[model samples]
Target: MSGWALRTEGLVKTFTLHLQGGARLPVLYGVDLSVASGECVALAGPSGAGKSTLMRCLYGNYGAEGGRILIRHRGETVDLTAADARLVREVRRETLGHVSQFLRVIPRVPSLDIVAEPLVARGMAPDAARAEARALLSRLNMPPALHALPPATFSGGEQQRVNLARGFAPGYPVLLLDEPTASLDAANRDVAVALIREAKAAGAAVVGIFHDTDVRDRVADRLFTVEPRPEASRSAA
Candidate 1:
């Protein structure tokens, strides 16, 4: 709710395709962006424009080739782009949360436990975390009978709901979401929007890829468009 919770200065990323004679594919180049606490910033662009790639870079899943990904964590600013692996892990554990388009969890873990794991890792009692997870899943309209089942058995929409519940549960200071409502129906999408608004109101800086314009409009304070640099420019670089 004060200064910027996240900022990227001249961020650059490229993928080297070993299969294609080490062709360098530049996805992000000198991308500068910022999101203040209590703000929701939407990344908008055509498909394959690197929206998701930027989110992953911000989350430290993908390394940036240049520039800084500055994140405010525990009252300190750390550049994730250059931070050590341990520091990045600590930041992710205590300050950043991410919700991806797909659900990835241990194959045999129950949906309830899957949603509660973050909370438990952060020192919440297992019972309390499970209770909170159950409540969130219920709010998302997940059936009670399916709570004990593994998310692997759930439908795409249902798995997405579980993913959302987990990402929102920790209430981290910074959140990166990639199509958070991608597999949802209208009703569930509305619920997801409400949760995003609630996060912003609570002073979480949110950066997201929202393909659904209506949801983007409802939650985004601003938009950052990712445009691929021309091939000629890449070669020159």
Candidate 2:
């Protein structure tokens, strides 16, 4: 438990876009990050400051321009930068969990399936997955009768809770949350924060990108901020 769960060294990322004028842009200039086992770290920054991009890099959604990402899995250390998509997916599905800025739910998939997806992905039997999902949903204060319903029509807070239940369903050891409480009202925000604390208590290493100061203060054991350095104007001497 003393070892790090995730570590990144000299991580870098850039975005190049083709416009009518075709210009390139640069983002994420060599970031170094590390999260200890069972630690809760908050990533906070202004808009367009690359917090999401950093998450993407850590999760292997986007390849870093230059750096290494190391993930500790099942008593072994693996360099995520060198792992294939299939391997990354395996780690993501089994050992690492992610909650997105926007909830991504299938149009026709039932809420139970959404929560059970992680366990099923890890090859648990359908019945077992359903049982676990139900327990998690109940822990979120979800009504037992509504466990079978599609969550699209639920309130924003309910939807976020469903999202939480799904991400936590498999009990993945590490969780990366992007604005997990972004859409909640005051009361619901408290619920979301409590759930977050529960995750940390259950020994999951959690990194959350927070926009709200209160949310950061509530859930963060450590904090990070992204700042941009000013580019001095060029003048001929």
Candidate 3:
């Protein structure tokens, strides 16, 4: 229940703009970040500083152009950049959880099922997963009536709550959050902060991008500022 839960070494990512005749744009450059169990690290930087890109890379949604994304998976260190597709899927199911700023799930899937799908995917019984999902949704103040309804038509705040519930429900060892409290009111923001505190207290290594200074200070143990790299500019085709 100690030491580093997640770390990146010499990590790099680049984007190739096809429309611009394959102009290459590099984002991260040898970024070193380590987060310990039971601690929360907030990513701080201005717009276009690659904070979102870093989060995506950490979750294996984007391939690292170089270096490694090391995560503790089932008590072993796994380099995500080198993990095969099956292993990456397994890692995502059991070890790492992410909450994006926006909610994106299958259309017409009820809110409850959306939150519970990950748990069920990990082999938990459907009933148990649904039970946990119901509890999380209730805790997040999503009305009971909306539980059986799809979240696609929900307000931004409502959809965000469902997203948070889904991400926090699994209790993954390492959690990545992007603008978690963006659409919530003050009261719900307090609840979101409490959930983050609880996650850290329960030994989840949390990395988050919190533009809200008040919420960031309340939940984050420290800040990791990702400075913009001058070399990230697009190179000539």
Q: Please list all clashing residue pairs in model 3, or write none if there are none.
A: none
Q: Which portions of model 1 miss their true places by more than 4 Å?
A: none
lDDT order of candidates, best first?
1, 3, 2
lDDT of 3 by residue, 108-180 (tens): 8999999999999989999999999999999988989999999989999999999999999999989999999
Ranking by TM-score: 1, 3, 2
Output the worst ten-in-a-row residue range by lDDT, candidate 2.
228-237
Question: Which pairs of residues collide in model 2?
Answer: none
Residue 59 in model 1: lDDT: 95
Best by TM-score: 1
lDDT tens readout by residue for model 1, 1-237: 349999999999999889999888899998999899999999988888889899999999999999999999989999998899999989988999999999986889999999999999899999999999999999999999989999987899999999999999999999999999989999999999999999999999999998889899999999999997787977866
Candidate 2 per-residue C-alpha lDDT over 57-128 given as tens digits, one digit per residue, 9 for 90 to 100: 888888887789888887787788889888898889878889887677688777888999888878999999
Candidate 1 TM-score, true structure as reference: 0.97
> Least accurate stretch of 10 residues (summed lDDT) in model 3?
228-237
lDDT of 1 at 194: 96
Q: Rate the local accuracy (lDDT) of all candidates.
A: 0.93, 0.81, 0.93
In terms of TM-score, how similar is model 2 to the real structure? 0.88
Write down the TM-score of every candidate: 0.97, 0.88, 0.96
